[model samples]
Target: MTRRVEFQLIEKEITRIDSLVSRGETELSWKSDGVLEYMVELGELVEGLWRRIKSAQMNVGKIKAALDAWTRTPLIARKDRRKDALLSFDERPEKVSRRYGEVERAAEQIHSLLEENKLLFQVGDGMEEPWQRYVAYVDGIVMESLRRAVGCSLGEWMLDVFCYDYC
Candidate 1:
């Protein structure tokens, strides 16, 4: 999911698709099949989000459990002197998890959008030359938005656990 790797995926797959098109080796049926495969991946992500949404009520407990795990992390070493500074909540329990309520709301918004757009995306992806269709253009835009939201959510979760330095 790193920036460097994303387009490699697009490049590898899209090149094959574009090649088939250029060689006039692809028929309408193949285009439809490719679109279906793409939608299926998108659908799985949406489904995972839906399941997470359904389990939102337990997230606080999960977060707490994960936070507790930090103390037991082997990375913290037996002779580690950095322990106090690392675990100190004295500076305040960081801003990332502090805003969990809003984050949950935002996640819910994405879940709602997925529910509303699920069928639309399927239909849109199935359209003629959908890879070049106008509706497909919008789907790409929405996919970007979804990627942003997903990145934000996971980033915040990582920050909350001090898995990486906070911004």
Candidate 2:
């Protein structure tokens, strides 16, 4: 279905942007001006894609309804319409089912990547510091905002405080 094609296009664009971000990370210093600009540009692109995905999800829902209607309708229509309905019945179901999952995975990946970018700003926590593997910077404005919002300093929150095995 057309929604599947559109979804694939969005997926490709997200992947492209991610690749660019990854390349920049490898090629440029994290504290360099170029890296900051790249991070902002990447953030903007991800936000735009997020908005598009929200709207696209609605469009996909509409297309799914059309597919449902075609499948449920009587087969007494004109030849072309009947042919289309039949073709859609065969192809649309799988695309309709898979597109949602694909979009959801994309959204989750984007969120994770964005969180990683944000995490780069946090430092001196000393708790394994997985974020260290990504980038380095001292001015954690984003982390400060989060700290203000949460009313606590995450850097001081020792990993041992959490009982989860993953932590």
Candidate 3:
């Protein structure tokens, strides 16, 4: 889950930073280059995150698929939100939470990583993380994509890795 979230952010950041770079014409200033260099670093991380997410996703999918062959997808006993149900019934919410946490941790890491490179920007060096402002935007896109892509749906595939003991 965390891997998925990080993967999504990494992709979006690469696109966003690249676009900013393309539109930028700042006279080789340190912040500009810091942005550029960090963007490059971000791109590398994003690609790495994507590969890992895809692998984890497929692995989870495979695990689910295998379980699906015999395991019945559990349905909610009463009408309730999926997340609520998943938290209450899904035995492996830890996996999702752990996955989600990984992305969160990465954002923290990248924030500092981006700043260290931002020294190249040669401006606003001390207290604030210069790159902090961009984190929310990129993180939002990542979460939104995953929510849009995989969440808000009911399907047989959902039941494999996450078995509903309550249902």
Candidate 4:
């Protein structure tokens, strides 16, 4: 999928996971058979979102590498001129620089999301019970992921919450 489409899918899944967590928080019965099934579905959704996050990270890495390679390569080689001569011959350096900037921005966003939620992703890894694990995972990860997916920085999110409560 295109990068835009992949990002859209990730955002959609984040919303869906958030909705599930909201329902699970207030409505789900911990001891009901239906709750077990709900937890199972949530687990599947989280796993899928994790996979997509990894894939997007990898793609960003690849694009950055390609941009790096392009920047290093000389469009023309002239032995008669100084080393700086090759810099002048570089093709559309501005375009490459803009593309590189875009890639770097994307990489930074993805990196920040992963870094912020690193522990949350592993919340229930060692748990022995599926329902308990899923509950923990949803409570720990979904809200944070939703915040990031919605393009809110931590400070911004906190401000919004503060405003909602006190303003």
lDDT of 3 by residue, 61-136 (tens): 4433332322232232223535444433443475456545654664465455444333422224342443354345
TM-score of each: 0.23, 0.33, 0.27, 0.41
Identify the leading candidate in terms of TM-score.
Answer: 4
Candidate 4, residues 50-105, lDDT tens digits: the string is 77567545644543443344333333323343432222334457745765675466
lDDT of each: 0.42, 0.45, 0.45, 0.51
TM-score of structure candidate 3 = 0.27
Which segments of candidate 2 are over 4 A away from where they belong?
A: 1-4, 63-167
| Model 1 lDDT, residue 154, Cα | 51
User: Which parts of model 1 have CA positions greater than 4 angstroms off?
Assistant: 1-127, 130-132, 163-167
Better of 2 and 4 by TM-score: 4
How accurate locally is residue 61 in candidate 3, as Cα lDDT from 0 to 100? Answer: 43
Q: Candidate 2 lDDT, tens digit per residue, 111-141?
A: 4543543333222345234333322221232
**Residue 113 lDDT, candidate 4, scale 0-100:** 51
Backbone Cα, N, C clashes tallied per candidate: 0, 0, 6, 0
Least well predicted 10-residue stretch by lDDT in candidate 2: 152-161
Which prediction has more favorable TM-score, 1 or 4? 4
Residue 33, candidate 3: alpha-carbon lDDT? 46
RMSD of candidates 1 onward, in order: 17.1, 23.3, 14.3, 19.1
Q: Which candidate number would show the highest lDDT if scored against the true structure?
A: 4
Clashing pairs in 4: none
